[model samples]
Target chain A: MNEMIRSLENKPGLSTVGGIDCDLHPASPATKTLLPYLEEYWRETFVMRGVDRLSLAMTSSPSRAPINVRSDWKAESGFAGDTLEAVRTQALDPFGTRLAICNVLHGSMIMHSDDMAAALCGAVNEWLAREWLDREPRLRGSIIVSAQNSDLAVAEIEKRAADHRFVQVLILAQNDEPLGRRRYWPIYEAAARNKLPLCIHAGGSNRHAPTATGWPSYFVESYVAQASIFESQLLSLVAEGVFHKVPDLKVVFAESGFTWLPSFFWRADKTWRGVRAETPWLTEQPSDIVKRHVRFTLHPVDAPDQDALARTLEHIDCDDILLFSTDYPHAQFDGLNALPAAFGETLAKKILIDNPLATYPRIAADFQKEVAK
Target chain B: MNQAVLEKEKNAEAKLGIVDCDIHPAFGTPNELAKFLPQRWRDHLADYGQRSANPLVGTLPYPRMTPGNGMRRDAWPPNGGPPASDLAYLQEQLLDPLGIEYGILQPLAAGSSTLNQDLGAAMCAAVNDWQLDKWTGPEPRLKASISVAQEDAAAAIAEIEARIGDRSFVQIAIPPRTIEPAGRRRYWPIYEAAEHYDMPIGMHSAAFGWHTNSGAGWLNFYIEEHYAFSHSLQSVVTSMVFEGVFERFPKLKLIVVEGGFAWAAPLMWRLDKQWERMRSEVPHVKRPPSEYIRENVWFTTQPIEEPENNRHLLDTLRWVGADRLMFSTDYPHWDFDDPRYAFKVPLSPTERQQIFRENAKQVYRLP
Candidate 1:
């Protein structure tokens, strides 16, 4: 109710002006074949938001569409109103940035079929180039590299990283092999070389069960289950020495909650000697390495744990490791103001304003210049 | 950003009395446990001979359960004796100047262990009886959470209704796993019975059930699953809230025990946010979802980050309301990390007392 972050009240004049996850959908035939799930209204004007785009919650379940637009639609086809345009008219008025999609990752895209996956990748990139990239000042993208195809992902990263518009390298949190099990370090190395952050977004575990046992009846369980996927990412990258191999490499635990960050560190730090005693070659306290290289977003806020959150931050050694993100338009319903309400002004400032600026070194320059003044 | 301010509070720990909301007897006495069991089951254990007959111990054979992992088979009632050894330990080691003024004694074999339910229930009954006798005194330093036969809800309710008359017994302790949606009705009898009893329900985490865990290879170990296990309790909260269990049981004051509060903030915000659309599904509550949490739910802090930086933890505490949360030592669950190790997060002394003891005294009706 009361904001604690007065410094944040200053709302650091973001000269960089990039959003963490701005999703966009193309308007052409490519978009039709690709982002077939998007309503016509959602298809248009997504590029007008910001540079960084994160998750793609686009679903064909018209039932899932935001309210108010269901009654008013201009469509010639079955349930065929311009949904994107409708979204543009309603929701997009305030926030229409960029959309991040995987080129041809594990499983499928709009559809789980291979053809759909490939088509979705092309469709999103096309939308970026046409609706964003050169056209939209704020449109940014991630080169979706399929965990199923590391080479294609590597190529995608190399290609997209060369263009300033492509920001992150999006990989599904699930991997064909356990993330910490080596073999996957090449993706890290490539992204490290390209100076791009490797963003591991959850919801992609191909040929793998969502839960260790059975599916949870509720969506909340499924969402919370994503923490395991992140545990895998943190372990795979750090324990396997990806960060050590590629020192400059940066990783973001996209959409996965940050509370696990400290717990993972607390556990991972003890692993080599405790749970991981079997593997002695592992070097360094997992916390030291993680706090240095890993960054994650806090969204779909897990209702805050006043002491635990603070304890975790102390355990990890920073107030800024948790980057502020609102998984906007996703079922999570994280608003731009979610941080302010979840945390007080003191924490809201770090999580929302300063943390992001600190995590992405590329943006740190401008923040430094501002602080200098 | 305010390291100095937080440290200044850290230096002022002299005033904070470490409030441990939950602790256990390591394991209870078999003879005491024999009282709650059906004779057929009681006799099966007695056959072990006077020297070997421990009612509280069914002897689970998991080799990984060491002294440090919170299940010290020795600190509990030894397999062949009365729970005499652990009682000395609880008062001497626990109640002495560890700064812990009050401790909530729960069933030791109940949480995150391979301990079976029959024995778990038998032992829980034993624990309740033993604690009632041991913790009642003028300076009454110990408090007990009534242990029910959770697997058998009928007998569990009967057991609760039987001993709940003891004033020191202020809460019904259920392994967090037992506090589920499907199990809600089965346990409702206990909640209803407790309506006149005037005690809060305490839900502590144990090695009871597993929600799907993380990596397959990773899931094999308890270390990896502990993180996943924390989220499982969220399932219990969702069940209670979304299913209108809280609505049906308006007087239900449920406490989420041993559940770390880190992830709760997001889940609360997201769930409350969902009310924007799903409120029709749960029309019983007149206010925001947080109102329900503050009104009906409370959580305990253990393994809490000492120099907690998430700062959000305090914010969440503020959101949940300090009066709703309780401080727990998890006594010997890594030594409950010492309360002073925590509460160093730079809250005012009033905030510290509320988190440490005063808040618990109110929620748990602790002396």
Candidate 2:
């Protein structure tokens, strides 16, 4: 039994050199940090309201939760990715990441007031560009948008589109409504026009319980239920004709574990066959549509062992869907052992370097420009 | 017959007498269910006409894909009644042909956890009585689930108490979509009663509740709505595990019906991983979440996940052990699985017997 368990364990020494990290959560800027980026009136309003003193980080990922910060990665500030230096040395340097995308999980995106959400989201993008992207050559930014108001969200996306450093648009997996509804199509339209892959990360607005049932007592229940949120959004995107409407758009499910994909795809495809009339625009199979337009990041592999991981990947069938990610400083994996040994060399290269470049067009364009230089 | 031929026939007969964990038994007519309801509730049903959490009055919020309310194309009876509503038709279409020796009936129309608590309890009692009177009494091969309004624990417990000694009722049926997550203390009395009565709770995937099908909110299409069934059950399982349901009711067994089982292994892994880091938040959960799931939960396989490669499913079955699976056909539904072809992968004789027959028998405690 001991020998069997040992053999199932992932072998060490799988190097992730030059890998493009697709989902890295840089510490959210405190409301005070964003005051400089916000407009003058809003800035003063924040100070007067005492919001400037608030951390504004997502409650779903409390700083003190051991899952939120690895013991070794935690800094004196009581968080792991609090500063650019911390992110660089702790995440980038260790993984040998060629380029890492920064996803900031600030509470501002989920604010109920559309105007405040938009203002704070815009400030977050600007703060991200100036504070993190401008400082590190290897860093990239995801335009954090308030999904509550698509008009404002699209404006923010358009504002940030000119910056090549910004490669994707970020939104929570759980929002006011399902992301595929026409109410939010303008955001997808803007993302497609700008060639930015929309990254739906795990976390929500608390407009509803994290589960379809009512609220959970423990955070672990909320955390584990994130995968289903991703599933619902994926189905919505396919069923609502988002892919058909915006053919150029790409979707990235970050921190949404990939092991659930196989079963989800099966259920989606099977149900779609019988229910195709309701979704007339879905001319193709749901799984095929997902494979064509969607990509998932690798973190919290969720499989029990190397064999299970390999089997899950095989069930997923498509090799191009997985992009490499560490979900850095969130304690997904220990040390630099981010890529599972089960990925093998060939698949690892696709997940690490090829898939991300293909998913994020700006990154590919930037890499091309760098090569020419 | 020759002695060798007789032996071969005996073995084949034994193997063919498999237990199907999920077989829907619908009412023959609207009056069939009404007959079981108390006259006062019957009058209420006529006046109010079954108020649900869904927005639509008569139709489902998300309409089913297939005709005859998502029934199999051929499931409509020759004499004209809803699919699975006619016992003779059901026997012809599923039980006899599929060799279902013990088919557990899950009545989806119960709406046991609907928002109107009093009406919900009344509907549950009516459905439970209807199941016993119409189905189990006529067909000894068929068994009933004691449907209850789980939100009203006192009423649910009363319903359980009213049916405890009956061998015809094999398990207690609760809707996966409850007013609250099933693990909350408000629902503990029902669990306690289930434990005391030695009845496993069968939480079948349901569509109606106060909550939207998805955690994110109401989805646009039926495909998305159908997909939410698995997610609903996933949350229930997660809620139960983390909230220490198993720790409290150590001997209580849960059989998740209609919801696919392939997601179980991954859910267990995720629960264990989070428990290691966030155990302080749920200290009452004495062991890893996976331990409770392994010890307490049984998964029914219907609408079985058909991956691109069959071997991948075998790997999942291996991870979620063959002992944990029970065969379910979801008969008369559009996405029903044919028992012969449901499992694409090869199973050893022991594994096949366990999944197809013995496991469900043990969980439901059937003769």
Candidate 3:
């Protein structure tokens, strides 16, 4: 598949020195590729069940969608983001990324059985640690957890927390219930304790229709509708007292565009004003809480026009809310123009370096160590 | 007080407020609708009551953002009735005080999108009759929308045809969150009827209760659910454009009441981007989706997306075209937009006149 990902033959103009790319999706390795990492029991079960391969590709980003894989970026035979070489050439090296957080959205968490999900999650982490993190010191990974089982999810986080390479815990924006429900609080507790920011990327388990109504007819409807899901999850996080419960938890919304933030903040605050009594735990306005706790990747910069993009940023008000990302191998923007035009010198430095450092302590600590040396 | 005095009085009133495109007129009680239904269905109503798909019996599945299910706290009738029920209160408190020249009534009754098709039609007919007789007939400033159970196209058309000649009826109100996207051919008869009558379809945000607000699943909070309202409208707009509703009925006009207009610009841009790449899939769509949008659709400006700066709002208005925006108060809702201070942006007199009055006047063909 001759994909249209313009090769990064020349260095991009953006100054990305010591910049932390918040979101770079790595393709899930084939199940057979991960057999060595998995326990023998799980390996035997995979063969017995005839589950040789698994593709947890979300419908929202159908691999065939032009937006999903640019014609130039398409691999000849494998998934586009599978190899680290692609990330190095197309994303990290060109942009001069110091550290790029890898969020591996794979079929592991969506597995039917809880035990299988836990097993696959563990194997995926091991594979991520040994293959990607070890291969490139510039790369760090998100700890994938089987949100299907909270106990196992906590254990997985505990196991990965020891490795400083894991910067955050990965979850999808669309879960069976609101992610803030008490049932999922255990995972949050572990994430906070481990000092891993909870990263909820824009893909769901597909348990329900992507819209409030039933299924959407077109890919565009589903794609556009992702913004609403992000809003819902954000509200759920606030309204359900997730922030109140886990005060230390920081959230990174990768590929969750930031243009809608200002509007959402107003509406959420309005709702909070009216329904304050229902959720007594919410002490501050949603906008204030989101600004303090939430950070978003600057990919698929929803504002297509430069002027509107500038206005959206102005409306966002808080300077620290945006983290930089190339959204590697995904065809959100064309070529070296992965950075939206509005990211001038000051905003660019903050988004690419300062903001990420402030949000992720591990990266900041590592950068400090490098500076001292 | 002859012709000269009357002319002076009219000129004075014309300077008041712009057209209020989103006013909700509620029935004081179930008895209001019962009067118009046949005796048998009336008994059915009394026996079974309005069997909503939502589990909540007397109220909506989720509580609204406002104290009284998203209705304005002050909007509750001074007399013992639901908010927006008293005609005199509406006149004095809203229409008179706001200086509204024409107030479009959007009746969001329990059975507007009822599952029982025939019963739904009957309920809608009752709503229409009640709106005219109780509100529009008395207050000349108030206008009626031919409410319909859109799931049943033939009945909806019949209802539209029944009120087609009445000048008081300006538009056809369809549930925004319908069982199917509003553009399916199954619902084309209603659009055809709207075009035949030269009436624009009015899509206001009301719960159909047929499905959850999102394609995913039920929303847990009213705030989250409220956000889905705009998403629902966007989906309907996309459905209408891509499904060729505009192409099929080119002259058809669409007035999306209550749903904010800020999203229209970006949504259309996204559609045009996609259509450019995927035009072959929908060959019937003769023009770019945005072209159809600009020519056929107008949006109401209540629950306006207030970015921190007023300039952003103005830029959005410009993108969607000032001619495409109609001023709406959402008179009785908690998030109602007051015409005086609703738009934070500074507007030229012409821009104000077009958005507040002229756009709606042209769309509704109001005298």
Overall lDDT per candidate, in order of appearance? 0.53, 0.86, 0.79
Candidate 1: residue B169 Cα off by (Å): 3.3
Model 2 residue runs over 4 Å out of place are A1-10, B1-14
- The lDDT leader among the candidates is 2
TM-score of chain B of 3: 0.94
How many Å off is the CA of B225 in candidate 1?
Answer: 3.8
lDDT of 3 by residue, B1-367 (tens): 1322211213443475679999988778758777888898898877877776678655787777565567888888778787888989888788887779899998888556676788888888888888889988989899999998888888888998898888889999997777777777888998988898899999988765566666445666766677678777787788888889999999999988777877776576556655654555577877777789999999998888766455666667777899899999887888888776777776766777788899999999999
What are the TM-scores, per candidate, against the unseen true structure? 0.66, 0.96, 0.91
Per residue, candidate 2 scores C-alpha lDDT tens digits across B56-166 of: 765677777777668889999998888998899889989998889999999988458566789889889888888888899999999999999988889999999999889
Better of 1 and 3 by lDDT: 3
Candidate 1, after superposition: displacement of residue B337 in Å? 3.5
| Off by more than 4 A, model 3 | A1-13, B1-17, B64-70, B269-290, B307-312
- lDDT per residue (tens digit) for residues A1-373 in model 3: 0121122112233666667888887776777888899999999988788765656555655665666566577788635776889878877887778899998877787776889889998998999999999999999999998676899999999988999989999987776776766788999999999899999888777786666555666666566667777877788788788889899999888877777776687567765776777677788988998998899988766654666667667777888999988777776666667665566788988998899999898888898998899
Interface root-mean-square deviation for each candidate? 5.9, 2.3, 4.4
**Which is better, 2 or 3, measured by lDDT?**
2
The superposed Cα distance between candidate 2 and the true structure at residue A183, in angstroms, equals 1.3
lDDT of 1 at A243: 73
Summing lDDT over every window of 10 consecutive residues in candidate 1 chain B, give the lowest-scoring window.
B48-57
Give me the displacement of residue B245 in model 1, in angstroms.
Answer: 2.2
Q: Which of the two candidates, 1 or 2, achieves a greater TM-score against the reference? A: 2
